[model samples]
Target: MSPPSATLPAIAVAGLAKTYGDVQAVAGIDFTVSQGSVTALLGGNGAGKTTTIAMLLGLLKPSAGSITVLGTDMLHDRHAVLPRLNFSSPYVDLPHRLTVRQNLRVFAQLYDVPGPKQRIAQLAQKLDFTTLLDRPAGALSAGQKTRVALAKALINRPELLLLDEPTASLDPDTADWVRGLLEDYRAERGATILLASHNMAEVERLCDQVLMMKQGRIVDRGTPTELIERYGRDNLEEVFLDIARGRGKAAQPAQAETAA
Candidate 1:
């Protein structure tokens, strides 16, 4: 694929929706993630965060609407953009028998990364999983596996990175370290990161914008500070609680920021 126009948003979804039987997993939602920013998708369980991310990754076909990722149509031209993006989720497991290094090498090749071995080595060292590289993925502890998963997601140095609960299973110190690594990566590469996380503090710290979803629809969106102030709350967590509990002032449909 040719280079996308720099002015295009990293991700643009219009009237995006998905359903299963009688249940609508994601109601019509429209939003765009600006290029070179960290955007957080926040919601409680069954709120469509995962469903939306899956559609963005082209892992699940949307029942309606459209998704343009990195300026390429996801439904019809995903292959043209897939190489430019990667996703990580702790809930998804790697093959149990493959060693950490082996697993990363496989993903590296799939992304057509140059110097797969060197990229794997760089990631293992950067993620502090060098010692676990030879261990079977199933043999690693939860935190170890989380680090390895992150390494795999980053193997290709993708322009877009999607993460779900990125710091899950990590201790406080390690989680903070990982967050710093992500911040540095974005700073260096101007990468766009879209993450679904329950960790409010992490979102407040890393995200430039936040989209709050409830019942499959995006109910609110703004910078963390903007949301907090608008809700008259002390912090993002409080604002989140207000929205989740249906006590906060109702929000109008978001006009996604073109420059976050």
Candidate 2:
């Protein structure tokens, strides 16, 4: 009845709050991420973006409210939901002593992935890591490490992918390649991605919608085009500046940026 109430979103956060003593890291934020789309979280320093993501991944307990991922309530059924999600961050590291292939093997086993060898081979080929597989992870270049980290994230074919600064420290060419790869992955699998990034251009290119945060609160949200239009700017960077400068209301759909 009633169309079966529709399926739950890939991710749902309601009245979510988190506080560290006197510092309220996140306050009453709510949003939903539909299945098979990319959602970008944008924020300046100390905006609670990291804290919010930590909670979504079940790495931290929320001070209040609720979170659900893929129809499982995070607070009540985290163990059931965690296996369906995976995270990748350029700032984090795999074991330095392990070869790239070994590192992936470890995670594949942890996720109880079937056909681990075939899965690793497929991902290595798809992600251009065939040669690096045998190389020690710490010995690889920064860009190479990023690729390996991504490979680890995809090893299990997770339903929900969480990325924080995924392309950080990568050269423009390499970053573009990685973006293309992610786009292909999304198109192929219809997976949901929640990305936290400072690269506005990349965000505009990859994200269908965005949540903008400031000082631990979600200050605004919309599609890239919607926010740009609302802020009277040609791009997201200017819109970000406007919000940071306390001029969020001045953003109008008609204002456009001058070419540099």
Candidate 3:
């Protein structure tokens, strides 16, 4: 059966912009993620990917335009709905003195997650981190911490997950496991995921759709295959390179910025 028309997108943004004095960090860009879809946001170092995610999470107010999450205005109703979403990144760290279990418990409380202990136990087992649960977060290896961070992100059983280089710093084997775990979680829960990663292999392996951002705007978007074919490339990394280097016709001609 088709989804209900009134079923709100997991996320939606139109003409979103973020400015810091003279720096147009995120110029007007727009996109939507349907409920339960896994999408990748790809870009180079100075692309607007970080600013865009920050705006969507309500951490940074957009200078112009609007954002809707689960059908309501995020700018106005963020508190009412922010709990339904969560984010994970290797760059961020849990408190050094907190045990893995303690960290999970803290986030569970923040998210008002019911039966927090039981949820933590389940996540530890699922993520194969049961042995590390009682250890201080600072004691963990890079891969262990990555798994723990992912568990914390999942503690709320979020409807939407934002992952920023989730598998970063891990060895190839561990990264593969993390990717597989994410794939399973989304499959089992029908959750929406917004992934921001420079890992093209990971993107092609996990994302259903890809959006390429450059110089504060989205220049092109499509599935891995679509972009590969469009760019006449063998893989997503090649396509990403072509776009990042302005080598393809897909690059949109830069237009004058119009504040919303």
lDDT of each: 0.89, 0.86, 0.86
| C-alpha lDDT of candidate 2 relative to the true structure | 0.86
Instruction: Locate the minimum summed-lDDT window of 10 residues in model 1.
Output: 251-260
For candidate 2, which ten residues in a row score worst on lDDT? 251-260
For TM-score, the strongest prediction is 1
Which residue pairs come into collision in candidate 3? none
Q: lDDT of candidate 3?
A: 0.86
Encode model 1's per-residue lDDT on 1-260: one tens digit a residue. Answer: 56656799999999999999899999999989999999999999989999999999999999999999998999998998888999899668999899998898888888889999988888888998888889999999998988888888888888999999999899999999999999999998899999999999999999999999889988889999998878788888987787787775543223223212
Query: Candidate 1 local accuracy as lDDT?
Result: 0.89
Clashing pairs in 1: none
Expressed as tens digits, the lDDT of each residue in 106-202 for candidate 3 is 9999999999999999999999999999999999998898889999899998888988888888899989988999999999988899989999999
- Which numbered prediction scores highest in lDDT against the true structure? 1
The candidate, 2 or 3, that scores higher on lDDT is 2
- Candidate 1 vs candidate 2: the TM-score winner is 1
lDDT of 2 by residue, 92-175 (tens): 799999999999999999999999999999999988989989999989998888888999999888888999988988999989
Whichever of 1 and 2 has more lDDT, that candidate is: 1
How many residue pairs in model 3 have overlapping backbones?
Answer: 0
**Which 10 consecutive residues of model 3 have the lowest summed lDDT?**
251-260
